[model samples]
Target: MRGEGMIKVTLVRGLAGKPEPHIQAVKSLGLKRVGQSRLLPDTPVVWGNIKKAFYLLKVEQV
Candidate 1:
């Protein structure tokens, strides 16, 4: 859905040695590497995931 309101999530830190759940959360957000970013729907579920991996990510409104 082009032009839909969303949040941008960027992997700001490496996931090396992170816990499984945190790694999963980053992957769930479609982040594959440090500096990788994804535009995701502005929803609570997505927000929850971001919160779970807050240490590894940078989030901004888009």
Candidate 2:
């Protein structure tokens, strides 16, 4: 069966002077520009990824 839940998240900030790890986290989430949204599985792994860039994103549900 397919998963019934998903997390909607977006990259809403820039990388100017930010740590390399944080910038890389955004890139790892397949975000390369501001205001880019990416839906991911609502799992701990996904949560961890989001946590890494918590201050740099805006998440919402659809």
User: Which lDDT tens digits does candidate 2 get at residues 1-62?
Assistant: 12457778898888788999998888888888888889877677767777998999986654
Runs in model 2 deviating more than 4 A are 1-4
TM-score of each: 0.90, 0.82
CA displacement after TM-score superposition, residue 49 of candidate 2 (Å): 1.3
- Alpha carbon lDDT of each predicted model: 0.90, 0.80
* Model 2 alpha-carbon miss at residue 12, Å: 0.8
- RMSD of each predicted structure: 3.5, 3.1
Highest lDDT model number: 1
After superposition, candidate 1 runs with Cα above 4 Å error = 1-4
